[model samples]
Target chain A: MDPARRLGPAQIDVVAQLGVSTVLLGGIYALVSVGLTLIFGIMRVVNFAHGEFLMLGMYVAFWAYTLLALDPYVVLFVSIPLFFGIGVLTYVLVMRGVIHASHNVQIFTTVGLSTALQNAALVAWTGDYRTVRPWHSAVVIRALGMAFNLSQVVAFAIAVALTLVLFAFMKWTHTGRVMRATAQDHDAATLMGIDTDKVYRLTFAIGIACVGAAGVLVSPLYAAYPTAGLQFVLLAYVVVVLGGLGDMLGAMLGSLIVAAVEVVGSYFFGVAWKEVFYFVLFIAVLVLRPAGLFGQRGAETLGV
Target chain B: MPALAPGRWVAVALFGIVALVPAGVRDAYLLDSVILILLWGALSAAWNVAGGYAGQVSLGHAAFFGIGAYSAALMTARFQQSPWLGLMLGVALSIVAGGVIGYLSNRLRGPYFALSTIAFSQVLLIVASRWRGFTAGSEGIPVPFRPGFWTLGLGHVAWVYLALGVAVLYYGVAIWLETSRVGYQLAGVREDEDAAEALGIASRRLKVYAVTLSAAMTSVVGTFWAQYVGFVDPFYVFSIDLSVRFALNTIIGGIGTGLGPFLGSLLITSLETYLRATFSGMKTGFAGIYLVIYGTALILVVRFVPEGLTGLAARLRVRSSRAHA
Candidate 1:
């Protein structure tokens, strides 16, 4: 590499650090986007309130930690099932109503749900930025000539593990197969004796569960606030779109790409322009290729 | 105009009552609330042009609104220009921005278009906050309180009249669009873009026109907002919350109807005012409780009454007529 382009030892170490952190960030992004993508893929309905669900999970963890003095990692077990049930309930109460409505109705229903949930949280939690300060939150480990936050590393490990588990479940399990069939073709799945509605509910629950897991993992790294999910949700939208809407593997890949862009772009152009850079990229991708890297043909026009 | 219908007379009577509100109500707070209601009514009506009639839901309308606010504020502050001139310039800029966003994102359907609008608005927000030289960054620019007829400092009553005038103008445009050939083409495009395009409706061009008109009208409201408030901040001017409010008002009032946005704005503003008054003394985050209500109300409205208040009224009117028959 040219000396100007080549990084010195210290600079290389910084790059390595950035790379590791970005991967960790990508893991979290993938976890968030996976659920969002899954919901869109199967139901063809974008869950605008998806981030609010993540926020709900964070609050679950927060309340557990505050009231019971439980570790956030420990609270994840409770939060995941709780979020799953919430998702199922939301589907039963709200999603089922708008499932067959016009595109605009579907969009606004979620948007409305999102606005409601976010404000409900604001009313309940008072918009305070609460964080779980476990002992490991501040701990940093040095490895490969670079330092990493212990909390971030643990979160990354959990995110990747959960993602793999989800992948395996979808690939090997009967319910997962049925869900996939439903996603591929709802009418066909219905004809094949699969309860498509049940599958949708389950899929939505599982998607929300993924967000709950992500929220638990991220609790130590970020604050729990009413609007905390807004930024992450926007990023998840970018990741899911970039990965090709409704493609799990693509969402994972897209998450990494987005994380890398954020980390590297922030490093290069400054933090303020990081979103600007990616949003421009998002618009470009939409304009140039509506169907993302891994999306099915005509998927962009599917719901419409 | 042809002989005015009884409903038109009723509308005229309503306008007469609204025009006399300032004289009857001397409370500054009450006057301010009414002005806000009028402003929101105008804004929502503007949004309805693109979102309701054209079926292009723009969640980033705050970008145009903020652009208008900033342009007007900057012109008045930096160059000591007349606000009316600045207002015109701001509307022009907003229309151009709207045209660009419309052209670029016109290919996207539904949620994708909404997402692009959001991204665009966020980008503008970041730029407005960072470009401190022009925007004064987050500290914001103040519109010098030049209290004159031309300078738009003619007291709260004058502002109410100005806002009401703008609201009426916007409502007129909306009604005109609803009844015109362009309106039919936009509706066709909204109903089925492929079918409309096949029918040679020039869907993209129609959308661009709708969005440009919507943006220009919204920018006019933005200018009035700047003058009324005498201050402009990027966060307030370009907030996604503002965009949501516009959509919510329209949706709640009734989408695609001439009187929907006005009724929606009135309901929401009155509800907000009432909630704030009742909860003014509460210490436990009661301030945001109304928003929670708004959100819940939005979901409920979309679920059971998607056509909103106007739809319900129409249904009721039809039912009454049937009963009479």
Candidate 2:
């Protein structure tokens, strides 16, 4: 009787749940950060409205599910393209003017954009937090000792897939080569007959589309509100900066580390202490490695 | 100058009329809104010193504001101190905090400063929310009705307006700062840091000075705010919406102008009042819609009338005066 009571089922489950939850959280972090890293890699613009794009994508999922009865994952087809168009529009109409403007104008314009988009969503959706639920259960896997939700699994799969696709494109494609060249030296790329404007438009669109996809994927697991994406967006900024402004590989590794710190700290202290953990991590990184975890000397100027 | 131009005398007269609103208007709700407008205007003007003049563009002045409110409230409520002493201590704390934040982002340009300020504000919010022993956590500490001439009460709206008058006095100081040597130096720093450095101006010192000054002024407003509202809460103090409104007030009126914040506040206040009156049920949604429209208006203004209302007034003055001659 003592042997049977020693290893309680609940205690075993708790240990297993912590391990599984931490890994799943890391996947979510990676997904949120990938697009941010891509945008920084090429344009060097911080995309302050990046979170707004995610919010818009959430609305897309909500509307499609509410109106058309489309699955949340199916809504991705609509969100990705729509967000990409908006991204291109943003790059062409707004970013073009402020590309060479002072830091004041850069921040002012982007902040202005963020405010506009956020308000637009507010007016449209009226601050209601909505969630899309499928007919069946979303939790699919129960392996070893813990269960995995369908949304989280799908989010992880999509993230990994997109990451691989982006990696392959950057390594092989001619247009991708031009993007790298432009990121390295804008004038040199222009002189080399590579159209930098087109590159910028595509890069920005793709980056935004990535967030759009992430939004749709996570709509099932998380409630979508006007300000839902804000916390993650802020965290993504910290991750991007920590990874080095424009380094893709740095983003993935940085996400893992940041996730580990956040999840582990949250477990020990409480859920509310998560932000404290991240801020401390950010400050520590800033103090010890000012250029970032993997940033080069000149990479300080990576993001505009 | 144009014949219809509201001259400096008229502006003075307008403020005089405004100062007597509590006496004139007996409604507590309307008077409270008036106090809110003035407070927001003062905070915006303070923000402009660092953001518009020094080009720091901080999105986190709420930290100082929140800290000041809590400090003042905590002291007056628990320690039984006078409001005036609490006010001074609040400003001092904000100055120190501002100095540290400004130093951290001193080397970084543009959005980094804004981002860091946001970070600091977030941290402040977290601390205020978590430190239940001091802050009372999310429930917030209530300042009781300690109504005395010096205690800063919760009952009389007149006293609140009077406390707000001190904020207006500081706004006067800010106007003076605009025309002074520090103002020009700050402008020089904003336009070209290297050129200012070459001209023997200590750009970093001016930036830190402006930001610290901004923090001090904002904290003073916060002290009065806590007293007027009879409470102090982290969300109420350190909200990003307040920060956005600070930037909006300055930008909508005229980004770098001395009187921009006043005009912007007047316009926005009137608009908000009217909206609340007419669309009370749908205020939040309406405000969201209005913000979108306002954003478009801002873009248009930024594109065509970048100099803002003050510039327009100045232009009309020039044209009409020339015509008269």
Candidate 3:
């Protein structure tokens, strides 16, 4: 609250530097959040286990790089099909039974799944923080007096590319359209001869795979610990809500805003209280626009 | 007294079993385990008041728990006041906080409500962690042992008695709400908010009332927990894990079912404590084996017995009665 402690003339470049770093961090957050929103949008199920899958994905990359000598970038591709299979299996075995259950039941189901995965990781990895040191681990590019980690740039680029591909798939592909139709109205889509169940399965698979890929992408950047994904998971939830629960574009935009606020807030208010600033923002958004910035006017009340 | 109901008889029997645990088992470790069951069960029962009965699922209920622990913990640590005084003060504090949160989530549903609750709790957690001067931050506040009924600084066996009495009182409140007029109204609101509103149930007001009362009850137990542990920290008391545990216990037991939370707490907490004890001294990698099994069990429960143990028991009773007939 002090004037001297507030932004001064010399802090502009530092702000710019923080802003640049945030964009890269935001991209990774967007990738994870998009997957979460997709599942929520299509199935009307909030996947609490989502971060665990991401956590496992990071472990997959870490183990692969450590054990098999495969590069993390390569593991990003290798882990997708595996994660897709896991996602579909999860849907078939667990989600199928509770798809129509009460919201309370659905929430608990995911909560249970989340705990199981988190603890499973704890058991396997022994809570040691491991990081993947790929070939380009130390590569940094400096330009205009600001430095960017090469790996971060790669993640950002890939995230942007994936967002475009997802947009296109939803726009052009028949399966994508069917998925969209199911999301719009499950009953109508079922009536219109679309295999709504299959669509749900595919949407969940794609959604999980997306976050799994994000895990691989971030494996090089952050430590792969038992609870690492939890840190990101809470932030992803804040981002997903900020972007409008089921909106993809909104998720991306919200990520940048969240990332920027987090960076600046931490820089100013101290890192320990970084979450307070955005959580305050998150609460304000909920109070003012429950539907979120990009959400439909009445969408907040629509979820089953 | 009014005619004793069958359900009350079952509750009485369950309490009898719980109260007998300390008497039968003198192993301090085992007694601690049962004591946890009572504490967590009682807290989850409070959660069930709003979350299960009113269908307002909160992931931030630990904020109230933390608030209660701190209110009393701070009072005792700072002023050397009696914890009994802290307990009453915590209840008052939690009611206002929970009421405001309940009111905020009045229009929000599903993820919005869940997210709002998470934010509210995280805000408290951050404040508690950063406001080191007041809270002592993450190092935590340790309450000195001042043994007496007023201070609640009792020895181990006394803790068992105290915890059971509190648990019974909590479960009693839950049973009362289950049969009370307000309980039925809350059930109506939970089943269908729109219909309940149409019937002039004042659903919003009832929800606020439920959450506030639930929070107050949880805070009472929080004070008891602080005294029992003799230490309180921002991280342990206010963590998201604690909030999730309350919800998980309620759901695992049978949300809105009066006897469900206790049954859930008894089963899950006992198993968890047993697991941790068994797995604790194991070599490095095997430390979490118990938790892994426990979490998998949770998944299976949600998968097959989504309605919880009470619902399963009800179904079995119906089947057996039909066969007998």
Give the best candidate by DockQ.
1
By TM-score: ranked, best first: 1, 3, 2
Clash pairs detected, candidate 2: A44-A304
User: DockQ numbers for every candidate?
Assistant: 0.66, 0.42, 0.62
Question: Which portions of model 3 show Cα errors greater than 4 Å?
Answer: A1-12, B1-5, B18-26, B285-287
TM-score of chain A of each: 0.96, 0.91, 0.94
Name the candidate that leads on TM-score: 1
Q: Once model 3 is optimally superposed onto the true structure by TM-score, how far is the C-alpha of residue B166 displaced, in angstroms?
A: 1.5
Tell me what TM-score chain A of model 3 achieves.
0.94
Candidate 2, A125-160: lDDT as tens digits: 778889888753365788877787777777777776
Each model's TM-score, in the order given? 0.96, 0.89, 0.95
Tens-digit lDDT track of model 2 for B18-63: 7777677878777777777777778788887777767778888888
lDDT of candidate 3 over A1-304, digit per residue (tens): 5777557644666877898889988988998998899998889888888999999999999999999999878887778899899999999988888888767668777877887788788877788899998877689898777788888889888877777787789779988889999989999999999988799899989888988999998988999987788778888888888888888889999999999999888888888888888888888888888777888877777653
Candidate 2: stretches off by over 4 Å: A1-20, A135-137, A298-303, B1-13, B20-30, B77-81, B154-164, B282-284, B315-325
Deviation in Å, model 3, residue B129 alpha carbon: 2.4
B-chain TM-scores per prediction: 0.95, 0.88, 0.94
True contacts kept of 3: 0.69
